[model samples]
Target: MTETADAVTTGTERPDFPLDRRRCPLAVPQEYERMREENPLAPVTNRMTGKPVWALTRYRDVRQVLGDPSMSSNARNPSYPAQFHVPEEMLPYIAFPFPAMDPPEHTVRRRMVIPEFTAARINKLRPRMQQIVDTQIDQMLAKGGPLDLMAELALPVPALLFCEMLGVDPVHIGYFRRYAETTTGRDSTQEAVAGAIAEMDEFLDELITEKTKNPGDDLLSRIAARLPDEPTLEHEDLVAIARVLVIAGSDTTANVVSLGTVVLLEHPEQLAELKADPSLWPGAVEELLRFLSILDSATVRVATHDVEVSGGTIRQGEGVLALNGAANWDPERFPEPDRFDIHRNAEGHLAFSYGNHMCPGANLARMQLETVFRTLFERIPELRLAADVDKLSYMFDAHAYGLHELPVTW
Candidate 1:
């Protein structure tokens, strides 16, 4: 029973959503190429929920789905394709993150923090970001190799920087990391996920209070300062915003640092190009982003109204999963999409996604990625994988795609 775009199929009829890429960690799932070629808007069963969703694979269709105003990001919508199960009690905590929000409210809240992540702001913070990366590399050098790059450098650099950005005490970075991992961990129990959220909320509540009383030159303090003028925003709203920043900022950047390193090492020619020409570092970062689309599965939405896409119509309230990884690897957009060429114009890639809901911290992520890759390789020219690439454990089950650990030696 082949499921068409308009037909709602049951049981084994539909292909599973979130096709696994564990076998080829650096590439989008092989199934995506077929879907893009055949049924651009293919129907799939959500592995987590066993519900049908319209999977958008083509580059243009993905952009349209993401940019379309009728597509709602609200996970609370009954028909939305939920990645994991959240207990009813945990719904309040899980549902309201700005990324999962829709409409004018999302616009207002997103606008409030837009100034913090502008290219100028990230550029201003570049020196500090460089120092952070250098500090991590220095520590790694001091301790020596055969160690997990993820633990030593990849995770800490972003975690520490996010702590500084949000005015949270750096001493509590371990808790922040735990919150990120547990919340996104596919195997995490509902109770465990709820507990992590509760802990973060408690800590954020205290931090927000302190920021309100003694404002500093940080995101939380700045948002706190505006609380008086913003009548609709509440104390909890501040905590929610801070929580989003902590998880999104730390986890995604950390993953990129670890995964990007792996990709660069695999392609020494591109690595050499970066080493030879420092100016190419930025473009290399973009290409790495395109090649390693870590947030492939996070861009889930439900159509608010019947919307016509490339292949077929997404009926009102139907779930739509825009596979950013597939879009990035779409041959229609990038010629020779499988080839990891640093010089290729990889701009407009869906790595950070498209439209109003595009990642607000994209510039910050880019700066961190640029700083880390440029510095890490230059400092340790001999750095190579200590363990075989095939033996490495990739985080295929998590909400984001990355590595559990990257073993490297110089």
Candidate 2:
């Protein structure tokens, strides 16, 4: 497809293979545009398995596959060519909480847990989210010097919220945070990530045991309470679900807090407008999610049957990538796709994905981001980036696209 522009037939040969390996693929907009224009679906050697596989880059194509029954979401397929193994410790959540399942199955598992992230449910947590925001800002102010918004604010709010939601003991939150970062890191070695996963597993194993007797009002307890009557899922499945709820909820929202701050600081006029009118916070948060594009990879899927996607024929059993980041910025979908506007029409953005597998944590993440943006702008009207914009660092190879640290101050 597209004449195989720069067709790469060989990659490095190494153990763990292409897992955790990242090659910068989108440094040029034209390159991204070319793929979108001429080749939205094309073949490339599977970075892990060394077999040719399909990559779906356009919005419509990616969405189609996301909703396609012919493609499976089991990320643990040993034959599935992945860029990385999720490590055995994190294996329980390879696609748990219904993220890695197909419908009928995903639908049932997801329905069993939907009440936790419902609009009404998350709204009840907003004040707590706001309080976290307020307290973090107060602490940042008290520090009275250069403040990295990510470390001081963005990263913690979600960690605390997720810990509250999953019934993770606050005293042990420091332990889980390490795993959260490691599991989410694309550049981190497998050994370190495996250790973090082991730590989380051991910690959660003990918590799950304790919750059986002294269940709290958190998600793990609620889901655990349902296991006896639920025929499709077991105790292990439920425990795995709780693990995903904590990890996905924490990492995605934290990135939003961190990257969203960088986006606002880069756009001072919009930042000023936000400070003046806090009412616009929710829309602004959604817009930031669109602009920042944290998730660079698609939720992986395996072609269960031969399917023609975007004029390219993918064989049965071939691997496919649903490139949401490329799709979210599609010119045909978003007018002036590359520009960032706080009020941009984001009806089609895929930052949290779409279809039956759409992120269950979307409402909670938006709430946390909305609250942080509201508080940060309200209290620090003159907030701006502390370093030269060009010099600011980004984790280009990260599983999620985000700033390494957002240094900001009033």
Candidate 3:
């Protein structure tokens, strides 16, 4: 492997976590490739905390760290590697509830809403999801092209679908989308982040209260109904759950849709193969998810006990970042990892992570992606970028990596 300047290590100095990839937004940081080859469990300084932590780069080591019970996901822990450095007072409002909880609490909280995202449950919503996607595209077509796809379709389709799932009023979708962008955007001020969190909590609190009095056929309503039977689940807990769902279910999927479209458009030969053979859609979506590991850096934890991984031991009280992007790009697991072949068996990629803390909304996200890609290109076969690829702005400063805008034409 050709060693890039990013991989060069000297003395005992550690590189900052989340190596810069602005040079190639669509690709994993080349530093990860070197770390995987030389130091599978390389030490790095947390950019947020300014503390040293272990960064797991290989697929096996990342899976191992994620599945191990000794690794703690509690954000309250001083050692947990937080993506953003929020004030301690604001942690409760900002930190994701279930994802940052350690089981049996995490298990209990996750199980409360697990049925809502099952393949069976999400499949039942497929019709409505398709309708939502179609409506967004119809609106887009009416407006004509030479417009930002991110604003027209990529952002709204998933936001509308998530609102439908959570029984959130469609009118409030715009606010929710803004809240997600601000809270997750790296450049957002602390006051802005806190305000967004407060606004979300207030909205969810009201929604949950309404659900209790007039329950609906939605996830939040169902959770509200359980409050009478389950004393452990509080009203705030319901709000927190819904808040996380809104952020995860919408923003992440929206990113995948926009970024994935760029990938398909950039690879016309593979795009033609997909358009010609509908059977490849599912595999194409998986490949896209694998290729663009947007949420990889979010999988972080603090070792509660000494844990042995591929490279070395992670002693208790030390933070560890299991970079899913790096693992997906690890050539040890995937040959020619940089290549984006739709037919590659990209199963077991850590895009949604693995084990207990695996993203519960993964199935729903996949279905939405498949629907968007299948319907999009079929409806607009001539869809192509309106501007040069280099001119496109990317969300390198956001918690998730994606295109800031995708100007397209047909």
Candidate 4:
């Protein structure tokens, strides 16, 4: 059954929720716009679930659902929204530490790693981030034009930074990066995902043991420090935490850097404005975050109790997908939502989401982006796409929405 603005439909007539990546830069799906204006909380079929779930499109409704305590993020819940079907053998392995937990447990697990992501900690890394950005740019310049930007700069910047942060031995980065790619890429096969997980589990188990014996200032050592009293996080928990951190921190920033660069290049006027004034970099980052919301469904909440939203009622046990892309485009919240104006204040945008589950790595991602964007155009003023924008291949099936490879010339 599908719920529409004025009536309900059965079987063959369900309103389909299209979740494909955008073909045009900075464009929200047309279906999202239609639902927001017409059926703000329409019941549409999740292609993966084959069940009618609430697709909350309006900004207010999406934010409310994100912040609502009654809504559960735990995938273990009977009615929890699992975007893809998990194999029976893998059910127990999918309970990710914090992002997939709720309440006190979520709060506790997050607290363990909070110190690593604090503003001061992130601020301390700016110099190193700048160095990484510089080295990548220097190599690109030496190689001269016609480089795949994704490989030359975008992918390496964050991958190297994450390795430094995690204190993984430089020798292991090759395999680690391969495992991460397989695990996070949506198009990766089940066998590949399982192999990646097993490889990571073995590596992290040894790393955590080593860190326990000789603790360092890195995050793994910090987790080792908590092992004694935090019985909730056993050996398996430590591996889970490390795996999640690695998967979460790497590609997301890389994609943002690539996609954000494309967006800026598309609007030479905005690019020139930013290049002329470095002071605008911070605000420009925020606008880019808002304008290029990579995830179609950033926050998926399962209602534990009946809740009345602005448009309609979300029944208990029903899954609700809050589309950040749609909410970012809501006209009520952002004035002239479609326009990409770096001068506009896009501060309150839901790019990193809101409330308790907001991405902890947001500050780190911002600093990297600010540094990279500031330095790239400043160094190579003639930078432009090597091929027509339409000719570039995009990662529609990746965990993060980005170009498969951004070819560029300077």
Q: Which parts of model 4 are misplaced by more than 4 Å?
A: 1-18, 22-25, 229-231
Separately for all candidates shown, the number of backbone clashes (residues 3 or more apart, or on different chains) is: 0, 2, 0, 0
Computed on alpha carbons, the lDDT of every model, listed in order, comes to 0.86, 0.69, 0.85, 0.80
Which candidate, 2 or 4, has the higher lDDT?
4
Clashes, model 4: 0
Most accurate candidate by TM-score: 1
Superposed model 1: Cα runs more than 4 Å off: 1-7, 10-12, 88-95
Q: Give the distance in Å from residue 119's predicted Cα in candidate 2 to where it truly belongs.
A: 0.4
Global lDDT of model 4: 0.80
lDDT digits (tens) for residues 1-410 of candidate 2: 33331243546211221222123322212345676786677555554345556666688888888778888876655435455535545554443446776777777778778888899999999888888778888999999557787788877878887778887766655666566667766567778766665666666667777887898988888877877877887766766676676677556777777767776776788887878888878778777777666774646678778777787666667677676777777777877877778787686688888777888888888888788788777787777878876666666555665566877767
TM-score of each: 0.96, 0.88, 0.95, 0.93
Error of 1 at 355 (Å): 0.8
- Model 4 residue pairs with clashes: none
Mind giving the per-residue lDDT tens digits that candidate 4 earns over 11-34?
435565547745564577777788
Candidate achieving the largest lDDT: 1
Clashes of 2: 2
